[model samples]
Structure formats: C-alpha cells, structure tokens
Target chain A: MSTLTSHRTRPPAQPETLRARRLPAYAAPAIAVAALALAAAIVYGAGIGGPVLVIVLGALLYLVGLFAAANAVEGRRAARNRTWSALIHSAFVLAVLPLVSVVWTLVSKGAQRLDADFFLTSMNNIGARDPNGGAYHAIIGTLEQVGIAVLITVPLGLLCAIYIVEYGRGKFAFAIRFFVDVMTGIPSIVSGLFVLAFWVLIVSPWFNDGRPSFSGFAAALALAVLMLPTIVRSTEEMLRLVPAPLREGAYALGVPKWKTILRVVLPTALPGIVTGVMLSIARAAGETAPVLLIAGGGAAINFNPFENNQSSLSLYVYQQAGSASKYAPDRAWTAALTLVALVLILTIAAKLLARRNRLSR
Target chain B: MGETPHRSADAGTGGTRVTQSHEWPAGASARVAEAPVSTRSPDGSGLGGGGALPRARAFGAERAFHGLTLAAGTTVLVIIVAIAIFLIAKAIPALRANTASFWTFEGWFPNDNPPTFGIGALAFGTVLTAVLALVMAVPVAMGIALYLSHYAPRRLGNALGFLIDLLAAVPSVVFGLWGRDYLIGPVTDFSGWLNKYFGWIPIFGGDGPYGNSILLGSLVLAIMVLPIITSLTREVFLQTPTANEEAALALGATRWEMLRTAVLPYGRPGIIAAVMLGLGRALGETIALALTLGATYSISFNLLESGGNTIAANIANRFAEANDTGRGALIASGLVLFAITLIVNIIARAIIYRRREFTESAA
Candidate 1:
C-alpha cells in the first residue's frame, strides 16, 4: 500500500491553480473616461458633430476598448464575459438617458405654466392667442370619466378574479383567463372605436334626436373596457397568492365557502387588489385616443358626464399640441406634466402598497 | 356488516379506540373505526348521535354570489365577441362602397364620390415600423434585462427595475409630444449622418427630408417598448434555476458562457413572447405614431424619408374629419389593426402557455 501511494505522481504540479486574475476595481471607470476623452477630441477636431454624437461615439469606443483591453490582459473567454457585462451595463445606462431626458424636459417646459390659474379655471374663454387656458375642465372631465369607469369595472373585475381563483374549474375557466389576457392587449383606440360604433352611433342616436353625440359617458365606457383586463389580471394574481390553508381553516370552522372567500381571502388580498385598481386607474386616466374619439374635447366645464362634450387632460394635451396657436404649446406641456404627475403618483402609490404587502406577508 | 361491531366499539371508547386501532390488523380494523364517523357526518359536523342534523336554508347567498361572479366572467367573453361583431358591422358598408380594392390599393380617398380606400400601404408601414422597433429594442432590452437579473446588486436591481416599470406607466401621448417636439431635431441630425455615411443601405437612403420619418417613429417605439421587454425578460432570467447556472459555472464556464448555456436556453420562449408582446404594442400604438409619422401613404423601404403611415395612425389622423363612408373606412382600418394585434398577442400567449407547461413539468 505504501509503495502504491508513492508511485501515484503528484498531479503535474497543480498547473498554477487555475488563477482567475480580475481587473482592478478602477479599470472600467478609467477606461470609460479615457474613451470618452478620445472620442470627444476626435469628434471636436474633425468638426463632425455635437454632444450627442460625442456621447454615442464615446460609448462605442468604450465598448471596443473594453473588449480589446480585456482580451489582451485576460484570455478570450474572460474578455468575452467582460465585454458582455460592459454592454449590459451600458445598455441600462442608455435606457436611463431617455427617461431622464423626458422627465427633465417635462419639468422644465411644464413649470412655466404651473400656476394656480392653470388649475382653477377652464379654457372656455381663452382664445388661441391667449396663454391663459387651464386644464381644470379637462381635469374634471378626466376625474368623472375615470371615476365612472372605475365604478363599472372594479366590481366586475373583482368578481371575475374571485370566480377564477376560488371556484374556477375545467375549460370554461381557462377560456375566461385566456380571453382576459387577450383583452388586455386590445389597443386603446379600438376600445374607443367599439364604444363609438355601439354606443355613440347605434345607441346614443336613439337618445339624442336621431343624431349621435359624444359624451364623457362614452369615454368612460371605453376606459372601462381598457381598465377591466388590467384589474382582472392583477386581482387574479393577488387572489391566487392567498394560501389554501387560510381558506381551509375557515371552512373547518363551519364557515360557508363564500363567507370564507369574503372574510378570509379578500381581506388578505385587499391591499394588492387596491394596488391593481389604482394602477388600472392611472392607465385609464392617461389614455388619449379613447378620450379623443369619444369625449369630443370641449373647452367648457361640463359637470354631467352623460350629457355633452367633455375633454380629458389627455385629450386636452393632444388638442393643444395640434392647435396652430403658439401659446398652445405651453398649455400642452403643462397639461402633459399634470397628466404624467397624476399617473406617476398613482403608480408609485400602488408600488409602495405592493412592497408593503410583500414585507408583511 | 362485518364492521358494525367494530364501529360500535369505536363509538363506545372514542379516545382508546384511536390507540387500539393502530395496534389492530392493518386495513380492515382501521377502516371500520373511521367508517362510522365519516358515514354518520358526511359534512364532518362531528355530532355523536346517529340522528340527522337539521339542514340550514339552501345557501341562497352562496348561490347568488356564485351566479354574480359567473356573470362577471361571462361578460368579458361577451365584450370580446361584441367588439369583433360591431367592428365588422360598421366596416361592411364602407367596404361595399369602395371603388378600389381594399387589399391592393395604397391611397385612401374614402370621402370621394366613389369612396376608394385600401389598407395596403398602412399595413406595410405598420409591420415595417413595428419590426424595426423590435429589432432595435430586443437586443438592448435583453442586455438591460441581463444587467438587472444577473449583474446588478439585488437591491439596486430591484430599485432600477421599479423605475423602469414607472417608465412604462408614462402615457403614450406624453411620448408623442416629446417625440414630435424634442426628439425630432436629434433624429433629423442622426438621419442626415446615416444618409451621409450609410447611403448605400436602402433603408438609410433618402434625400434631405428626414424628420418625422419611419426612423423617428420606430425609435420612439423602441424606447416605449424597451421597459416592457426588459422587465419581462428580467423576470424570466431571474427564474432560471440556480442549479443549472451553478452547474455551468462549476464546469469552468465564464459568466457569459454560463448564461448562454443555462439562462439563455431557459429564457428563449420568454424572450420571444416578450418581443411579440412588444410588437403588438408597437403595432397598435396610436397617438405616438400618429404624431411621429409624416402621415404619407407609401410602402417605401426608405425609413429615413418622411413618408410612412400605419392603420392606427391613419385612423387617429383622419377620424375627426371622416364622413359616413370615411368613418367606416377608418373603422375598417382599425379592425385590420385589431386583427394584427390579436394574432401577435395570441401567438405570444401560446408561447407563454407552452413554456409554462414545460416548466411546470420540469419542476
């Protein structure tokens, strides 16, 4: 046994232990800075382009330089890995650019008109030349339309989700789930067109002296269609997250199935449901095509959604953007900022609620 | 009949019966012990007597609630069917009135005396722009997704991912306004550069006019879709089993190689689904494309030229002034758009469903 052990050679001296030599922590940032400087010099010296061009050229140069340097220092596989890592990180940076630009532009352009008058008054008497028009009327129209849409969709969407999570079985349930997914992908404009064809052209003519009229109610209907799938899908996810043991526990105590769902399941999923509803509401409030098609953007403060023309903030932005008035641009920007603010607030709130739910659970 | 004596014994000595049952012969005695309680209280009421318990009222509220939820579920199906039916109904009259072939003709003159219109150019532009957007978006989105899923620190990844989702919530009209007002200048400059450098390429070949071209529209679309693809693909990549990933790494694979062997293969279906969903979104985008495209009716491949039109954009552009037949024509175009998006979405869903089954079975 000792002779056999001695005869087994010592594994060829271990071959440098497969050393994985990593680049220093400062390597990437140093390389990026040098690349940018080189790109800027070349671009400026050649009189080729501006800051945007320099940035693009710099990013390209950085990627190439990173690959080459890594390939030279490390072997090909490690270089390839580093190159991909750099590409991925840069890709993220690239995406952040547009978001930053968009938010910056919105704020800088929108703040010029963010006054109390912009929120309190309507655009009714403000002429094209006047820069005094506000989105108050549009804001009101948006609230009423979104409110009515929420009223119609929430109960229906909740019940559908409950049905799917609690009692769903076989092909019918599958079909419902599938169609709900399909409906979620329906374009906002098509929903508007559906409302226009069914309600405005066919049904509303009966009420409005043989003439079709646009109303906020039509917009609400369209928004409801848009909101339904989102709410249903979200609520379904939240409901499914409810544990089976909770339901069984209630059942063991002589509680009926419906009561178990109502008392145990729904209350547990309530925060998530609210999050979904808020998200859907945010989406509905930002929709322009449907509102433009059905609400018939009007300047006046129309309180009754069922009656005449009403303009939403989204429609107001679109109209103001398209209008020939020079002052209209400011109003459009301001209205857009308002719309975005409203949407972002709702989205952030929903996300916060969702996060809280995850922690508590 | 053989179990009756055992059942009576079980009932007489409830606590002791449980202990004795374990000691008894394997199957028959245990069955006999359990049978009387199960048979007597089918609903598991736990009542001791053999006498029947009084039944409650026929669960009227439960039945009512079930019916209400079922009706709500049914309503979604009804709404989908109604949309298609109503669209077809509205489109038929305009189609009948068309002097031109709806499939082949390029120009839209639906308001003319004979009312000639077609979806040829609109459909072409729609497909072209959406394809271009996906081509530009998918790679970068995959990269971003990989960064979030595999590269960034967990907390940072989560925060950045949340920010990206908020980007999705930004309204299309806001994108439209920004694209038209702010992005047009930079896009025009880039188009000129492309024309100067890559004029031999058919897509980049165009004359002086460049702003509001298909290139601009597609760029906006790419940005708009970037967040969606990134978020979805990140989710999919994160779902790649750590075991598979670690196995590749343990086999002396580089980070990229490990991802290629494990994460990429696992996420192929998900990536395809995400791309198709993005395509559907780009196809049906109305206001953004409406504002970005030059609103010309041509099926040219010169993306840098200021000439492109999509069905959704055409409908949004012409709907306000459309007469009876023109409205029908626009509705017909919208129906066409709807059909295209429906096909894309269904294909995406199919891929997702199949992948789900595969994963579930594997798991």
Candidate 2:
C-alpha cells in the first residue's frame, strides 16, 4: 500500500475528521424537551404542590440535559457556551415575566375607576363607604407640592452644578460632588423624617400655637431635599458636555463671564436641564412616605399648601389601600395607575428629548 | 476692569489681587494686550476715554454669582448634616426612656409609658430582605446586561434596554399594589412549593400560610432593583474594550469564553458598585416592602413565613399612629437606616471614584 501510494503520489487516509465536531441545532431542543417532559412527570406524579416546582425542575433538568448532551456530542467548550446562552435567555425571560405582569395588572385593575368622576370630584363630603369620591384634591396637592419641589430643587441644583462645572476646583468642589452623591442615596422616608423633625416639629411649632403640625409645604420641603441631588447630578453631567470652545469663544467675545454663563451656557444646556428637572418632578410627585408623614393625608379638599393637611395621589393610594371600606381598593388601584401614567409620561418625554438632542448632534 | 482679568486668569493661585493687578504673572501682559482694543474703542464703558472711570470694586456680579453658587453647592453638605443632627436631637429623648435594649430587643411597642422599642428585628428584616433581593437580582441583571451589551443584535438590544430603563421609572407604590394583589397568589403558591421540597432549610421552613412572606417581599424588591443593576452593569460591560474581545476571539475563544476573559474582568468593579447601589435602594425601599411584607416585627430566619418587617417600612407604618416618644423611636430607627445606606453608598461611590475618568469622560 505504501509503494502504490508513493507511485500514485497519494498518502494514506487519516483516521479522524479534520474539523472539530459540532452537534446539530436540533440536539439542544430535543434534549430540553425530553428533560422537561421527565421533569413534569416527576413533579406531577410525585405530588408537587404547584407549578413553581414544575417550572424550576424543568429549567434545572433542561440545563443539565443540554450541558450533558453537548458535552457528550460536541465538547466541554460548546457545552459551556450552550449553558451560558440558555442562562442568559432564561434570565431575560424571568425578568420580563414580572415586568409584563405588573403592567398588565395595572391596566386591567386600574381601569375600574378610570372615570371622569375619578378626576373631577374630591372627597370633600364623601363618607367612608362612598365610592363616588375622586382624587381632585389629591391631584392639586401633588401638583403644588411637586411644583414647589421643582422650584427649590432647580435653582439650587443648577447653581450647585454651575459651581462644580464653572467655578469650582480642588477640595471644595470635591466635597460638593461627594455630598451630592451621598445625598442621592438618602431614603425618601428619612427625608420625610427630616422634614417632620425640622419643619413640622421645630419650625411649624414656632409659627403655629406651639403645636407641631403637618402641611403640604412640609411635604414639599422633604421632596425638595430628595430631588435636589438628582437634579444636581444630572445637570452637572449635561453642563460638562457643553464644549469648551463655546466657553472660550464667549470669553474671546469680551462678554462678562456671568453674562456668558447666563446667556450662552445656560441656554445651550437648557433642554437637558429641563429633562432632569422633569424627571425629578416625576420622582417627587410619586413620593408616598414623605407626603404621608408630613401632609397627614386628608379626606377633604385642601387648596392651601401653606397650612393644614393635604393628600397627594401616592398618599391617597396608601391610605385607601389600608382602609377597611369595600370600594377603597378600586380608588387605590386607580390612583396607582394615575401616578404610574404621570411618571411614565415624564420619563418618556425626557428620554425622547434626550434622544432628539442626540440625533440633532 | 483691572480686577476682572486678574480674577479670571488662573483663579487657582489664590492670590488677593484686587488692589495689585501686576501681582499675577499673566495679569500684566493681559492688561498690556487689552491696551490696543481700549485705545481703538475710546468710547467703551471701562474708561469711556472719559473723566469718570468705573469703580475698582473688590467684587462684581461674576464674583457674587460664583459665591452664590458655591453657597448653593455647600447646601447639600449642610442639609445632610442637618438631617443627622436634627434626627439625633429628636431621637435622644426616646433613647433616654427606652425600657428595652435599643440594639437587641425584638419588639417595637414604643408608645408605652416607658417606651419599649428596638431596631434588632427591623434591622434584621431590612438586611434579610435587601440581601435576598440582591441575591435574586444580581445574576439575572448581569445576564441581561451581558446579553444586551454583547450578544443581542444592536437594534433589538437598544429596544430592550430602553424598555428596561422604563421599568426603573415605575414608582414603588405602584409596585407595592401590584405585588400585594396580583403577585401574592403566585408567590404564595411558590413559597408553599418551596416549603414542601426544602423545608429543612430555615429560609424555606414554614407551614401553610405564606402569602406575605419575606420571599414575596424580596422578589418584589428584586424587580424594583433589576433595572438599576441591569443598566449600570450594561454600561460597564459595554465599556469593555473591543480590542480585548477581538483578541480573545482571535485566539479562537467562544463568545462565552471571550466574555469570561475580557468583559467580565473589565466590568467587575462596576458590577460590584452596581450591586451595592441596588442593595442601598433595597434597604431604603419603604412603600413596596411596607405593603408586601406582613409587618410582623419578629426576628426570625424563616423567609417562607408570612412575617417580615423593615426599618423604613416600620417608620412609614408606625409614624402616623405614633406618640411623641414613638416618633423619636422611629427617628432613631431611621438613623440606623441612614447609617446603613450611607455606608453602602459611600463604598459604591468610592468604587466608582477610582474609575472616575472612565465614568466622567463617558458623561
């Protein structure tokens, strides 16, 4: 055979295939199906209490089967790759389940109380048993509280950002940036407690007849505290993005520095600043704990934010959810829906604006 | 006019140059350079080439504005310190009369004659629920992050990423209601199944009633935290250099292998920071856990039981009905929560600080 091969200019055949072997795509699905079927039989026949067991067992069994089949048919490397892919896909599926389920439940249950009456009439004279009451007062409370928060937070946050990006340097700047980061992590409840201690307890007593009182203004202060750090951080990011050439050009134009900042820097960064402010507004608007603590949720309408109790949509939801009345759940669900809608709208607007800015650039 | 150039030029030097313009090295030359422009425009406001020269004031609108911003910036630090001081000042009276150990007692009946409250149970529940949430969330978040950053097609990745971000915007109270009503049934069933199969473990050890269990609360918390962890980790994973990934691929590495060698190693610190941030949020979460947890203030390790309570939740639940002493107790507990979150966030910030160039430049 060697002599004939030499004469024919050919060599002996190799025993193995040249390329690395790969299992067919169908192999994984087949194994997974087999594993899942076996899992169902074991779980159901073994008197498992619920579907959770079945799903968990099926997933585990499928993973094992895929890895084992791939290892045997292909190799360890391919098995690892397949396992990771399966894990990643399953993780995404798992996350999507809760997200979709929550949204679906909100829409389905919230629709029960999504009437015009729900928006128009306040619970001014309604009894506990009445279902005709609305969130009109709560809406007003939220708007004013959140509006005040935006007012306080925007100027201070923008100024803090300006100090950081324009005038700040060294330890003081570092300190400001660091504190802003720390402030962002403050609990909303803690912020509420702060306002409770400082504003409602200490300051309000000084104003009132030596009695601690709750008010929408106190809630606004707490929300402002919560919102300030967020606005500062986001505004700082946007301000940093303003190109240096623009600032230098303004300087070269002999424009006063403050005028340049007010006219050029601010106008250039206004859209992003507005986006940050709106997002903070949405966040402040949904704060339940702070308003609950400070405003002391009201049953009747209260237009004045300066004094007396007020209800926000979030506080209304919490109060209603905890009430023993039959119709309270519907109101609670609808309030939740409205809050979600409000927040999503603001968030969507901000994202769209950011996207527009990006596209135009 | 004389002081403006000195202040603007190399303001970092910290010199008192209001009266002495020639003190700055660049100030003299800058004034010299401006001589021609002023001469050409003799009617300009500065000298007006007229009799009345502008006052050489020590500060102007620019300096005042700078000082104003600096003061505004310092308000963050002031507010933070004020929160701590006022909370302590308020909490001291409650601590002075506590019948129970503040750190060790397991009950929270603070409205009594000699007020009795302790953070042990609340703190335990807070840490347990937050840790459980982290355990449940971090791996799934990482997987989603990796998928979005590396595996999925770009357009699909962008869409899913955007949707995930929208998940972050959903308020906690909405999540609370959803969890309490809709998620309760499935979670109860799941907890029952877990107890049946894994009852030996303390975490899964519970009998029939399991609707508002720690498992449910932690799962809800996980959902609340998922978007944050996912987005942060996605940002980090995306920042992994393309060259390193390509090098791994050139070495005949599989996609998973490349990720292991390149992406994961690069994103490790960032992932840690993200996880810490998620942990912080989970700890501070109030309304969601307040609704989902059964509000049972018992210090036990059984997660499958219909019993759990957190400090923030306790504050929200008890504050409305609390007496003055009770309010103080709640504030004290809030102080504890504040400390925990502060430590976590500081650690996170420190981790991110080390990589500041990476983050700031990306901004």
Candidate 3:
C-alpha cells in the first residue's frame, strides 16, 4: 500500500488569531446560504423572459463566489463527502417522494367517500353514476375467495414442509424441492389460466354443462396455487429451526414418527408456521389477476363460492379504475384504501399472533 | 437390561423374524411394547407377550398415521406438478396447430378472428421490463440496505426497516392503483419532456401522450419490488464481518471506500440472490403491468412508444375475453412465462443453497 503523506508536514502553521479560524468555519455556512439564494434567484429569473446575458453572467458569478467560499471553509475531503451525501439523499428523496405522493393522493381522493356505508353496501345492479353503491359484495367475495385459498394452501403447505424437513433425504426430496421451486415462480396469471382450463376442459367435459365460468371456488383454486409456495418455503424454514433434540426425545420415548412430528415438532414451529400462513393469506387477499380471470367481475353478494360470478375488492378496484364516471373512479380509490387497510390489519394481526405464540412457548 | 423380556421375545420366533430385523428404536418401553407374540391363530389365541393384541392394534394405528402424513406430503407435491402439467396439456393445441409459431410471431392480437398470436412481443416486453426494473431498483436497494445496516443511527434504521417491511406487505393491486392514477400520469408527462428535449436519443424518442410505456411499467415494477431487494440486501450486508470494515476504516479510507471494499464484496452472493428475487417478482408482476402498460400488441425496441405488453399482462388482459383457441394460446404464453420464472427461481435457490453450504463448511 502507498504511504500517506501527512498534511502536518507540508501545511503552513495553524492560525493563531481567532479571526482566521472562525472566519473559515463561518464561511462554509455562509456560502451554503448564498448558494440557496442564488438557486432561488435563477429559478425566479427563469420564470420570466430573462435578459439572457445578465442571467447567465449572474449565475456564473454566484457559482464561482460560492465555490471559493466553500473551498475556504471546508477541506476538499469534507466538500466531496457533502456533495456525495447530498446526491444519495436526493436519490432517496426521489424514491420516497413518489410513494408518499401516491399515499397522499389516495387519502385525498378516497377519504371523501370512505365510510361505513362504503364497507357495508354493494354496487349491485347500480348504473354508471349510482352514488349509493359500495364494495360490500366485492369485499365478501374477496374474503371468501382468499379464505378458501388459505384453507387449501395451509394444509398442503404444512404437509409439504413436514415432508421436506422431517422425512426428506434422497432423490424424492430433491424432486419435491425442484417442483416446489418451479411452482414458486409460476405467475399468478398462469395459475388463473390453469384453473380456467381445469374447469373448462377437465371438469366440464365430464359434466357436459356450460363451463363453470365465475365462482369463488375457481378463484380459490387459482390463489391456492399462487399462495402455496410462499407458505411452504416459510414453514419449511420454521420447521428446520425446531431443535433436533425434541425429535430425538420423542423417538426415544416410542412415539410414532407422525405423532412426534405432530405433537413435538409442530408445536415448536407452530408460531412461525402460523405466521407464514397468515402472510400467504395477506398476499392472496389482494391478488387481482387470478380472480379477474376465474371469478368474473360483477356487483353481487354471493356467499356461496360454488356458484355464480364473484367480484373481489381487487377486481372492483380494476373495474372502477377504468370507468369513465367520476363516481366509479372515486369508488376505485376508496376500494384501494380499503384493501390497504385490510392488509395492514392482517399483517399486524399476524405479527401479534406470532409474538403471542413465541411468548407462550 | 430393562428391555430383556422384550428382547428375548423379539429373538425367539422365526415367524416374527421381520420385526427383529426391522430398525425400530430399541428404547426399553418401545421394545417391550412392540415385541409381540406371533398369532398362530387370527383369533386372540397366541398371547406370548403381555397385552399383545392391544399393542399390535395401537402400533398398526400409529404406522397408518405415519403413512398417511407421508402420503399427504407427497400428494401435495404431486398436485402442484399435476396442475402445471395438466394446464400445459390443455394448452397443447396452440403448440400443435397455430398459423404462426408461438415463439417467433410478432402480433399478439388473440381476440381477432383467425387469431394470429405470437409471444415474441410478449417475451421481449416481459424480459426487457423485468431487466430494466432490476437495473433501476438494485442499486438504490443496495444503498438503502447499506444505510440501514451500517450508516443510519440505530433507532432510525430500525424504524426505516419497519417501514420497508410495511411497504412489502402493501398489496400489489394498491401499487397498481398508485401507479395508474398517480405515477403513470406524471411519468407520461416526463416522457413527453424527454421526447421534446432528448428526442435525438433513440430510447427517449417516440410520441406517447399517455404514459403507458415500457419505462413506466418498469418504473412501477421497480417500486413494487424495491422492498424485497432492500430487505434481503440489508440482511446480507448486516452479515458482513465487522472486522473487515474496521480494517478498512483503520487504513484511513473514507466511508464509501470502506463499504466498497468490505461490505459489498462479502455480500456479493446475497446481492445476487436479492436481484434474482427481484427478477422473479418482476417476471410474475401482473397488476402493475396491467394497469400501467398500454394494452397494445405491437413490438418495438423503442421504450417511448406505448405498444409493448408482457406475457403476464397479456394473459391477464385477454384471458376473460378469449375464446377456446384464444384461451389456449394465452395459457400457452403463460407456460412460457412460467418456464422463465421457474428457471430464475431455481437459480436463485441454488445460489442460496450453495452459499449456505459454503458458510456451513467454513464454520
């Protein structure tokens, strides 16, 4: 490594007078203030037709003046650091600003209509400008559809996790992992198409009836496919963390393998497993594409997922997003807010449950 | 010594030989419980051991339960695989009997009669948008991760990390909503400005009054995926050895140089995995693309033009309206998307596993 040359050896002696030291220290802040003033001036001048030469000349003079002051106050190292910090901070601000703006816009746009009525009523048979309508039916459909998905995914994911973590060892284990990896990456839309084809070709061909076009059950199947991998992967990690001694003790006690897994291993990993399932629920709760394809978008309250078209909150948002009517668009924004709130609630509940389980254990 | 009675029982009978060789745990209670009298009669006649009938019944039940759990696990794996294969089989018609090859054809107008649909445009749109999203997201994500892991004051970093987790939980549809009304409109205006000023550049050329361009879609995707990359990268960055950073700092290097030398190199594998995860999300992204991308079917290299559509977006947009043949074709496109995403995820998992192996071996 190259040896560093100390500034102490080469530099002039430190200023003994208070004025010299204080002046340089004060100069940095002063230059910063002047730089802001010049920027403001340039912006103001640009707002109007400028005397082009004067404006350009003024900007150059201001920059040079500030540069000299900055050099006087701060060493080159500090100046460069500040410049870099500003740049990084600006980029961060840029990233955050859009997100904050979106939230602000949503609140401003959607808050006027968000109320008890919005959550309790449906837009059933409402025309384009029906202001009385809400997303109750869509919310119900979303809950039922995602609820079924949770039911289907949790058991399958848990069982898969059990196998992979507890029983897996050889080629069978490798194959399972490979397939889960594949399923993990399947697009939401593909799952929707899979459900659609399953209903249309495989199930319908035997029944000889019009294909099951729009139902919460169909939406659930699609979402289950989407949610299964997340739940499995997370639960697998949780299961793996369960201490090996517990399994060994159970085995030594003559407990059956399945009994040991169910009683000892599962209890240890239960909190994390529940958290995984809850996260998967939150994930599927807002999925739009599969529901849009399988559960046709409409306005109706159908508690039975086995029959008829079911519109979810997400699909409702989509429907109103593109509608020309102002009410429709406003309703869309409110639905978005509603969806965000529900998801937030679920996330908090999941965390609470996980913490409770951890404390109890 | 306590298992002596059961051990003799296990050794005595040739007819019960299978149980002797079987590797049941030799715990005393278990051996005593499991060592059994052979039934010379199907009736309750051969009682050489105490409570042999009850033990046999209980053991049988336990074995059945074990068998059931294993079967259930394998069944889930089978179901997922079966579903994928079944869908591909159902979508096989598009492969066998399309006018144009699905991979090479440019047009994606599946709704039109005679249905000329190819996935080239969709593929291009999908890969380009995802890659661009990665490019835009990864650096900022890494910076945020490093800041949270190393630079930010402790409480501030924790708070920011919490906020980032909250961002991750925000529904994709909400992001779509945010993108559609809030982001796309301004982005379109920005694109117009780019076209006005930097029109000489090929990338910034093309007139798009509505901001549903590839760039807009990519921006939305980048935003949606930032939290994942950030969280993963933060974990990786935090795992970097403190001594490495201290050594660099001891050499009188600036903070940036310290990070560049110590933190980044150590987290290379993690950053790669994080990028891959982000890529996976980008590949499967539906709602944001659906909302932001102008749902047109033309393929152009120009990002400014609003004609490109991703496979996910196309499947989402047309699946409901598609006829049987059209539905088949859309599913076929989904199969392609699924394959690409699957490969990406597999590679990511492999890298993660390899890293784990390395760390374990080193330890």
Query: Which has the greatest TM-score?
Result: 2
* Number of the candidate with higher TM-score, 1 or 3: 1
Q: Comparing 1 and 3 by lDDT, which wins?
A: 1
The CAPRI class of candidate 1 is acceptable
**lDDT score, residue B174, model 3?**
76
Candidate 1 lDDT by residue in tens digits, B173-283: 998899999999989988998898799998899686989899999999898888888888988999899999999999999899998999999988888888887887888
In candidate 1, what are the lDDT values of residues A1-361, reduced to their tens digit?
8876765555655555567666778888899999999999999999877888888898999889888888887878988998888788888888888878888999999999999999999999888788787999999999999999999999999999988877677899999999999998999999999999999999999989999999999999999999999999999999888877776666444354566678788999999999999999999999999888889899999999998999999999999999999999999999999999999999999989988996235
Q: In model 3, what are the clashing residue pairs, if there are any? A: none
Model 3 docking tier (incorrect/acceptable/medium/high): acceptable
After superposition, which runs of candidate 1 have C-alpha atoms over 4 Å from their true positions?
A: A1-55, A358-361, B1-59
DockQ of each: 0.43, 0.51, 0.35
> Which regions of candidate 2 fall more than 4 Å away from where they truly are?
A1-18, A358-361, B1-56, B357-363
Q: What TM-score does prediction 1 earn?
A: 0.88
Range of the 10 consecutive residues with the lowest summed lDDT in candidate 2 chain B? B47-56
lDDT of 2 by residue, B1-363 (tens): 111243343433433322222222331333334322312333432322221112223465656787899899889889999999999999999999899999999899899987888999999999999999999999999999998988899999989988888788888998898899889998887787788779988878868589998889999999999998998899889888889999999999988999999899788878888888788889999999999998987899898889999999999888878998999999999999999999889888887787766756753
Name the fnat for model 3.
Answer: 0.48
Per-model chain B TM-scores are: 0.84, 0.84, 0.82
Q: What is the interface RMSD of candidate 1, in Å?
A: 8.3
Residue B111 of model 2, lDDT score: 96
lDDT of 3 by residue, B1-363 (tens): 111122222334334322222233443345445545344444534435432222334345455654555675676577667767977887787656577767788876655666678888898899999999999988788767877887788898878877776678777777887887878766777677668768889888876654788888899899888888888888889888889999999997667677778888888888888898789889988888988898776667677777668999888777767777887888888888878887788888888779877866864
Give residue A334's lDDT in candidate 1 (0 to 100).
95
